[model samples]
Target: MLTVKPILPRFGAEISGVDISKPLSEEDRRAIIDAMNKWGVCVFRNTGLDDESHIRFSRNFGRLELAPLRRDGKGRLAHRELFDASNLDMEGEINRDPSAVMYRKGDRLWHTDSSFMEKRTSYSLLLAHQTPKEAGETWFADTRSAYEDLPQEMKDKIENLKGENSLWWSRKLAGADISDETIENGPKAVHPIVHTHAGSGRKALFIAAHTKDIVGMEPEEGRRLIRELIKHCVQPQYVFKVKYEPGDLVIWDNLCTMHRGGEFDAENEARDMRRTTVREGTEPNSKDDDDPFTELFTGMPKSLSRLTAPEAEA
Candidate 1:
């Protein structure tokens, strides 16, 4: 029997007694996926899987995409689908880079994973390889609820409107490079500001990454309206923070939730974690998307050697 229980009423679950390191029985795998779809995030405490083991487990859900190249570090799992955010140096201080426009800013912004990708990540699995004594928490917002709360007029206005989301703009904010190759290969695509979950038929807000503007609206007008939507979507009431413990593995559905990393002291503490990204497919509402691999990585450097984005430009 499955041993899954709700960790919170809104968005999280905890599953126990199943060894994820080994091949899962078909029924067990289905149960876990069901739990994820229902809860949006699943946590496994005292998880025994190592980096490779964790990657294998993520594959059971869908095709696993390698963690983005720019997010890896040495002596860490930054190989193909794994990212190591461990012991990074920012201004001669440890962990200080958490707010670095490039390295750890995603957690500060409430966003669905890889929404900037042609095929946005469907789920994110993060395993805490090491946790500092006090900080390093992750927060999540229930977009499902965030959407339900919008005024009908706002909803109707965005119902047919599609957003032109771009990593190029985000990378630029961080001062990351934008090459001619990147521009040619990486062009902005449109997705509805609201998405209907394919599996559950639930709706969610899809806006993220300081999106440049809406597809058909003037930049100034789009900026104002998008800002209003973001403000409404990320209100404190719809969010929750999860503190990490060593050996805790977290899996989140990027389709229905936006997540951010919390503030922690990098000056004196250490934090290391591994993440695996899995994508089901691009949502039907997204427009003009193709070659997810290229769309997901075009503006970023070809290799992990240059992981910082434009935001971090000194």
Candidate 2:
């Protein structure tokens, strides 16, 4: 039997009584999923899962989407199916590369994983392998609760509106030096500002930092509205902060929440985390006139040209 206890009144729960590294019984799996649907986020302590087991556990919810091959400063894939969410380089040491560090800075902004992709992500499972002694945390906002608390008129105003999201735009905001071509070619998606959950039939504010503007609204006004909505969504009551332990694993529903990485002393401390994302049921609505850059860089970086190149080549 599994045990679940609410961590916050709004939308987070802590679950125990099962080892996630081992295969789950059908009953246990369903129970976990149900709890997640209700709470939007579930935290499992002391899971201590290896990469293979981590991937195995994540697959219970839906098909495992292959993560884009992201290289470290040395141009090496960190893990096969996991998105490296650490401050470390490919060699297991703290990363000093300027580009990698700037890229990581974007995590501090609130956003859902894979929102800019043609295939939106459903669930995100992040496992903490190493945690800093102080100030390294993840903050999650309950967009479902935020949506429910909205005034009827405000809800009506956004009920049918779509918001555009772009990875390049977000990275640029964080001061990352992204090339113009990369911005134009990168994945850009449009999603409903107010989305109804398929399973629970509840609505949630789907806007986040990845959201650049509303589809039909004036650019300045749309950005201002987005900023206001984000401010509203992250109010104290709707937020939950998790200070990770080495073996902590948090599974969150990307459909009903947004999260951001908390500030930490990256120069002195290390934080190692890996994430696996499950794809959403419906295809995403992309704004790009042609296939996004994600397709071109699916398995590896496009600059690599061919995978058969000698290992010595950069």
Candidate 3:
């Protein structure tokens, strides 16, 4: 039998007694799936998972989304950025110019992975390889509760609203030159501001960093409304911070949670963790599809792009 313990009253659970480093029995695996459906976040502690082990374990949940070279560099390594944060500089400043994108400085905005893509991320698995003396926890907001807390009037307003989301907006914020092909293939795609859980039949707010504007609204008005909606979805009462410790693995439902990286001395300490994302099929809301970019493999891996230069030099 599985020993499942709640980490928080509203969300999060720690699952014990399963050695993720090895193959799991069918019963144990089923228990995990059930726990994931019950609690949006499930944590497995100190399972001795290296890169290979982490990949293997994540595969148990669903199909693994390949880390594109554009996103993870030319080699496109097995795991994405999960490691000991202590490997950073004494001042915690992220050095290594070649690794700049992975170390950009920002207020760590809240978002669900690949919501901009037609195929959204179903879940995310992150393992803490290093811990700090203090600070640097990741925070999550229960989007389900965010929607529930909305004023009835506001809920009615969003019930029929759709917003355009795209990767270009986030890439632009990150200071990268987005290609025309990227723009054409990745223009804003529309999704309902509120979505029903395909599994549990519960409703959740479905907007985040990748969201650009509400369909058919003037830019300024849309901006104001989206800002308000996002704020509503990230209320303090629905949020919690996860302080990292070495050997800690956390997985969350990307559909109903919004997460932001916490403050830490990146200049003085190292914080590393590996992450894997599993995708749920995309289901867009009805709209004109104003985003010119809509190709699935356009700016993806050069190997998949028909009209790209040689993959970036390693």
Number of the top TM-score candidate: 2
How high is each candidate's TM-score? 0.80, 0.87, 0.78
Model 3: per-residue lDDT, tens digit, 1-314? 77899866766788998888898777887788778776778878787887887877777776565543332243323343222222343244543332343323312667776677666778788877667778878788788877877899998887988878865565444454556466556546678878997755678888877677788899789878988977887776777778777888888888888887776766666666667666574321112322212243344423223322111100
Pairwise lDDT winner, candidates 2 and 3: 2
The local distance difference test score of each candidate is: 0.67, 0.77, 0.65
Off by over 4 Å in 1: 68-75, 87-102, 171-186, 282-298, 301-314
Determine which window of 10 residues in candidate 3 has minimal summed lDDT.
Answer: 305-314
Give candidate 1's error at residue 25 in angstroms.
1.2
Q: Assess candidate 3 and give its lDDT.
A: 0.65
Model 3: how far residue 33 lies from native, Å: 2.1
What is candidate 1's lDDT per residue for 21-96, written digit by digit as tens? Answer: 8888888888887888788888888888887788778778776664433433332333556655455543323544
What candidate 3 gets wrong by more than 4 Å, as runs, is: 70-103, 171-186, 281-314
> Each prediction's Cα RMSD?
5.7, 5.8, 7.2
TM-score attained by model 3? 0.78
In angstroms, give how far residue 158 of model 1 lies from its true place: 0.7
lDDT of 2 by residue, 1-314 (tens): 88999987968999999988999888999889898889999999989797888988988877556544333323334444576677876567877566666666778889887677756778889988989999889999999999999999999899999999986677677786666566666667899989898757899988888898899999899999999899999999999888899889999998999999999998778888888777777332212233232353553223323322111000
